[model samples]
Target: MNGADAQSPVIVVGAGLAGLTCALDLVRAGLPVRVLEAADEVGGRVRTDRRDGFLLDRGFQVFNTSYPQVKRRIELPRLRLRPFTPGVLIHTAEGGRIRFTDPTRRPSDALALLTGKQDGKPGTGPGPLALAALGPLCALDLLAPPRLLKRLPELTTREELARWRVPDRVVDGFLRPFLAGVFLEDDLDTSSRMFHLTWRSMLRGTLTLPADGMGAVPRQLAEGLPPGCVERASPVAALSAAGVTFADGSAADARAVVVATDAAAARSLVPGLPAVATRTVTTYHHAATRSPLREPTLLLDARRRILNTCVLTEVAPTYSADGRALISTSVLGTDAPGREAALREVLAELYATGTRDWERVGTTTVAGALPAMVPPWPLSRTGRTASGVYVCGDHRATGSVQGAMASGTRTARELLADLRRP
Candidate 1:
């Protein structure tokens, strides 16, 4: 290494959002930093693919505007974000559809509830009066600031919901599938703290997709950094307190090292690290001549065959070209044989249309999509593994994009503070 190169720049492993965020913060502090990524591009799990004129995200993902870290780091207007309708459509087990909309966004729907006009809807889900009554309580409980949520005793999400007086019908019909999709689990065993935070985020801002794709998020972060700071397709074979060794038998010296890869990779680098369970998710994309559901609303399956599905083209027309519609479906855990056929059958029933003509585009399975947030989960953990060695990722905190960025920022601040100490 040259004299300048050997001068101890902070080395960051993996060019995902967490690593990129840390690098950007370090750069802003006028500190020299280097990022190594195994993939050819940044964004790790957050990627986009263009196939047959369809922009398919690596997995079914959504960008929330309410994440404080996102607001601080991202230029929202540049993304040209397209939003899903502020509510969801539930396909009931009885083969009926129920529409649950945010009263704040669609006052007409609220008015319909007040006038008892919603009773005419297909599914015998929660009645309008019941839904309207719960809205205020939900807003007060979930939309409260983070400090308030932190004060509450930690509990599993299912237990927390049990404490609430929400009707069983509402929980089973809507909240179950909806929260399952978010937590990537059907049992609602995630941390109640995470549940409240996620609920607050959703209530505070819209769920959106960039005009380009989810990959645009990481691209934006990477673009803001100094050129050549991120070295793609350079995988680190092992790590130590001093620096890292590359797969090519090369080594780099650094004052500090941050392992910002996924949970599995981070554990590999630092043995005996606390284990964080992860959830798996599989997303299937298909093309249709016309949209099965014309609205840009997420549809949840009450039967739990499919966690959640959305018409991506309806939410953002750029996802598809030539008037073709793109439908994205997500299922929890690994897919089994005949899963595609079973999913298609479920889709046909849910949309009340035939799926035989829908062209299957592709399927992407992420085994470690999000770290499982169980009770007693800490909002933030000390990123330091040892002197000069640290780690951060979704596993170190909550399991959302917001959590990932926040953890990265925390690592950056901690590293800077430690480095400045006398």
Candidate 2:
């Protein structure tokens, strides 16, 4: 390892959102910073692929516009975001569909909602009253003051739902599928705090996808940084207060080091860190001549075989070539043998269409898509590990893009404060 002066730049490992955010903040603070990423690209999990004239994200992911960090950093208009419908369409176990919409967004629908009609159509689903009843309850809980939610005792998400008086029909038919798609778990065992925060964000903002793809988010973040600030394909094998040793036998001296890798990678780099459980997800992309669902609404399965599915082309035409449709389906788990075939069969049933001609474009299986968030989880944590050595990622906060970026910002502030110390 080469020796260096104490004035060397701050080194950030892993060019994911956390690392990139940290580097950006440090640079803006007038501190020299360098970012090292193992992959050729900056986005760790947030990546887009162009295949056969289609834009496919690394996994099925969306950008929530309500994230404070995202709102502060991202240029929404520049991203050319396309929004999903205000609410979700739940395919009930009894072979009917329920379109649940946000009444606040569609005031006209509120009247229909009270009369057991959805979108001016009579409800033809299992337990229409139950579905209608869920609307007011959800709105009440979602619109509850942030201070009130914060003051409530921590509980599992399931318990929180009961406290909110959400009925079993809504829980099984709507919340189960929707939350499974978000949390990647059907049990609703995630933290109630997380659920409330996430739900509030959803109520306050729209769920959207960029016209170019999710990768555009990280690409935008990296674009604003100075040239040579980020070194791609340079992975750090070990980190210490003194500096970092790269896997390529190269070394860099830094006054401080920040490990911003994923939960598993962070643990590998820094021993004795708390172990975090992660949720896996598998997404399958298929090309169809026409969209099964013409609307841009997300569809959930009440029967619970598939987590959720959406027609990307319907939401953003840029996602697919002209005259072709792109369907993205996500399941909660890793890919298995014959999984694709099974998913195809399930999709056919869900959409009530024949899938014999639908072409399978790609399948992405992410083993550690998100860190499992249980109750009593910290919204933020001290990034300082040992003096000049620090760590930050989604694991340090909630497991979302917002959480990741927030952790990075928090780490940068902490590091800056420490640097200013005598």
Candidate 3:
């Protein structure tokens, strides 16, 4: 590298996936870089905490292998990801447990969910016709090109489902609750494009978690960078021509500054950035004596009492402490009066076990769990800012693991091209 390049390293604010990725790309391209993080560790919103030998992610999240960016950026085997059952179990208000399996993923289990005859029960499910319709819908989303999906008229997810003629029973009993957890909104107002892309990834990918925790994702990314590149506990205050001002009254000079925080933080850090509305979600972790239902598949409340619940330890034994099962349940908003009590009550009904003895390990409430995507949305962006600074995150593009890393990659290339322009 030139003497000038050596002196002025690129400064990256926020050591989340996007920031870590941007720094890694630039470092690999022979540029000196520094990453500043407000928090003590990486992963931003995608973080995990350890309590009593249990791994509690900030919220319920899974690593999707089918996300193009995930496959390209993350080393799957290194994570030792464990997949959930390719389906979900719905606990109806009527006290019946219904299973919905994705036939495309496991054809052998097709007969169960496809015909609505699980465990020799005829009327326990949504019926053959309605459930059968799902495969084609998922297949369409799985195979359709992004360009083609973008060309379609903009619509809310509810509208798109109506256009496809999905049965009300299937939607209300299953999709509605399932998607509430996915989009973090109960109304299904998320963009059809975003919904389709999310659904496509779910259909084509294995829903799994890293054995360590979600935080391990960003940790792996940060590890790839040169030592001392990421400076933790370093909060960036402002971006200036000389580079960045830290919250502690310190400053760092740089050739360029990139903001890679979450949507809210990014907007606060970079003035006049495009506004991205977001949704809130909270996850509660509880410890139980044994696994509930003996499967790692998500169990949804048909009554919508809780977004979804699962035995985390069933998916990964190491997530538990003292050989107890770890159960996690999420709801659509921040805390409220009697919310924890309500969560426990619903957990008992859903799991058919008394939660009186289960211990509440941790509760994580995320203000902006996901950006509210409404059409006409740009699935991807250039990460260019009007203030002459660079910005990248899930908020800049579609909200997902893919968007964060892809935005980081895009911003790095943009910065590299600018540096090369004589």
Candidate 4:
């Protein structure tokens, strides 16, 4: 088994976004690579289904134009990005609505949005911090690793919002709702490192989605790979410097291997990967007889508990077949059995709809849907890199499609560099 023989072929495990993207990029760079997917298909967390002529995503998810890695790596035309309206309507238990908008794209304005209040007004009002955070949000090119690392251990999200004089009530009501939708946490319980980075990105990019569904992004990458590059449903049970073996007893000799699955799965596949924390989210997809509103998307900020109602139809009109709306209430930390009841109570309080109106078109409860993305985020959770092994996934970065891609690319790049070393 020499360098040109079967002994040293590069093997990438887990055909999720990161794995697929990493494998594709490496092959494009003139390196030979093979991808193994545990499931019958690719796109691990990004599962999309076409139901009765309507596209339904497995869980509630969305992306923004500001994702630097995704923008650089993905072909935009293939996925078709749809922008989210600038404003998000907040529906309350009293059947009252308050709409929040950012007036500036600069940091100061973004900072201002932090402190502004609802003033008992519904729609068309600027919160305090919305104005101050403008510059920071719009300047994400300046907000990457080095720049962000400077503000750590001190300039936290809570601290930054407080510095802008964001009113307590508004932070509880407005900022919390926005953050919850993004981080999938109720309060600002997530780490400041993650929140600050996210805030900067949101300020830089506009919210966008694919016309097909979230899965389309992963699907496009998978299709671009060489025909034999991917082997579906071949779960690798173990790996060594000499070769790899699958659950069915088939094996392939490889000089290098990369594990790009979820954190939990990675721990089992690799020898010394750390444990990854988990969080839960419940997504309620109801086809309202009427529309949730004429608007396609709204972000509701209730008390510190339930986060927001994401109106999917507003972002992409094709989600609903009969013009019936698809309103997804995304609740984090909510269990499967209790999610339906919780959503009903919240919706009835917010939209004035009774149990009768929310006719339950569909519901999905994703436990560990999103890894508990708090600070001290386990960067080393990806398995230990021994003689011929590497690791990559959203867990290796932030829990996002782009994060996954970036990690995978990093792994492949590292492996290639190692192979070329003298």
Candidate 5:
């Protein structure tokens, strides 16, 4: 099964999180690896740009400290992680702005979860059903054994939530809108298993950002490898079991090839792809002279046109070079060049502050942002294809840092095991 020749390097066709992890693992196992990246820098979709004096991430991304791969690979102290309020702010016509804190973690927020006082005032809580369901729901996700959880029948997230007896209003108002941002699917059609996994992580981890930006995450991962292991601005024109031809009429021979690019790119590189369905996400970054919603909490739209918006500067002051407030908002689909005026109107309502003077710093649309995890979704799949080569990315597993790195790790382990066999 090993297609590689002796002393030939394993050529990785991307320098994304999955690629970085795979190459790093390979190098650790005493294999020569060369990472080819089409972009000028590493990180692929997980990139940051300095523009208009703002640190704008390519998409709205957060670093969860609790991811196993992240904890094992990244040095938390180096990133200087900044935490967001472990709760959400739901903005709706019905309830202007409702805050829900994780009373379990933040005892200082210190009231009943639904009945908890927010912004230092008596707040109206949820009805009896939601109040009763909330704690046990989180507890089950948090405390249940992983093997037991996975054995449950696969269902759509919405269906599973209903089975748990979450009232329809709660699903529509909060769960749907909030999860839409996370899963990049507004319908909650993602797998219940994926939903529970994420819910458990959220309960256990702190939602955070690197002081510098999300880009630092992959940069940190790549830093461990030897110098020149990763080659930037190198695009792969075609792939074969023997080697890869570059877009520039050059070729590099290899023992094996790993297609670690996104799902679309992987399809072009490796044929007969898995059942991939993805949702696109577009994030709009606006710079404002005046701060809005000064707290470092994510604002979810219950009305649900814009999935969520946050004051980036509130979480990490380094995100803004000129100290102007950086507001980032994300929508469920792609390309909204014409929606500037309307987006501003939504921001105006959400923040209760006019966005007329806010400058649009950047618009980032990540096609295939997340793999669509419909009912009966496979939590993980074999990356080895019939073609004898391999593929790895978030799409090969679930979509998250954990998923991407785990895919890379699993593929590397598989590849290494094959090589070791007599």
Candidate 6:
């Protein structure tokens, strides 16, 4: 049924972070928008599940307290936040562990490499090998300048390592592992623009989480919308100028159709969609006997396989009941293999605690979770081919929740302008 002919209203496909945000924005604008979700529940990747009175998130995710876009767009109080206690611990196999905190309090944190007693640790800090790599890696912040990325396409991880007069030892020991945690990619093959964006954000905010798991953000977005505005478990098979056809042969019409799903799903719905790049992030959640670390730190393991380990409970105690905690290990390269044996091998390499009789609480590997925010990442496809067709998602903006929300708001703003254009 055409939107002008249907009994309902504007229909948005996929009630993920972007879709929900867009729908809420449109509804608040009094556009009478409706959201359609493929899953039974809301929150595409940002999901929270309750088990044995403990709240569990689908994947290991964190939010930057400095996310300017999301912070300005949403009323964060709705999703109780748990801020990290101003520091991160890097647990290493050979070098031992060190804590890096906010530079404001410990101004020495920023000069740790030059200062011999940085963060109260031994040596000049981060070791000579790691320090050597920091030179070019730190220079990446320069790319954040206005439009600098256009001229520095060749300034990628590989390029920076090769050009910076740094040694191969520094690249291997420091740059590789450090960049892995930031980009979640084993290699530096990603675009230099993404590298700069990550660096800028690093300079921008503190790392934090919602008390109710990462899912709370999406939940808040969904609840903000009008009742009966979102239809769950209805996937859009194809979309045309007339309207959308669901997998069950049901159709819904709208004056404007927004594709707020993942890149692959958008390709299926919109023919000849822009080329998209994808990356996988593997999260290992452990229900341990005791809390691993009291404070949250981005663990950079020398093993190369385990990118980072985040103690979620310490970051946000509300995620688990008192006396119980949740720890997550994110593997950057590939999705955890389906074969139990391979998974066990990877886990053993990650936690150094071999996969054994310890019961696992929950584990997830997001195959299409992260976008390759590298160079050539596509621009916003909002206000695409048709007058009433729109697109919004992380794939259309930066790959973070902030990016997704920004895309949605921009779409709504543009839509409103289009309505008033006449």
* Best model number under TM-score: 5
Model 3 clash pairs? none
Candidate 6, residues 1-422, lDDT tens digits: the string is 23464244667888888888778777887788879898988988778788765676766677776666677666777767777655554444454444545455556565653343424666324555555555455556633563564355545667755766667645564556767766667778766666666666665566678887888788777888888888888888888667788898887667778888887887777776776787777676666666655556566665575777766777777777755767677775455446444555655554456556434666677767777766555434564534347778888877777778778777777766766674
* Model 1 Cα lDDT, one tens digit per residue, 189-307: 99888888888888888999999999999999999989999999999999754588999988988878889999999988877787788999999999999899898999988999888
Task: Give Cα distance to truth, residue 28, candidate 2, Å.
Answer: 0.6
C-alpha lDDT score of every prediction, in listed order: 0.86, 0.85, 0.85, 0.68, 0.86, 0.68
- What's the residue-level lDDT of 99 in candidate 1? 74
Model 6 lDDT, full chain set = 0.68
Number of backbone-clashing residue pairs for each candidate, in the order shown: 0, 0, 0, 42, 1, 3
Tell me the TM-score of model 5: 0.96
Q: Which regions in candidate 4 have their CA more than 4 angstroms from the true location?
A: 1-8, 92-95, 105-151, 154-156, 163-165, 378-384
Candidate 6, TM-score vs. the true structure?
0.83
Sort the candidates on TM-score, descending order: 5, 3, 1, 2, 4, 6
Q: Give candidate 3 misplaced runs (Cα > 4 Å).
A: 1-6, 115-123
Q: Which scores higher on lDDT, 2 or 4?
A: 2
Query: TM-score for every candidate vs. truth?
Result: 0.95, 0.93, 0.95, 0.85, 0.96, 0.83
Clashing pairs in 5: 4-255
> How well does model 4 score by local distance difference test?
0.68
Clashing pairs in 1: none
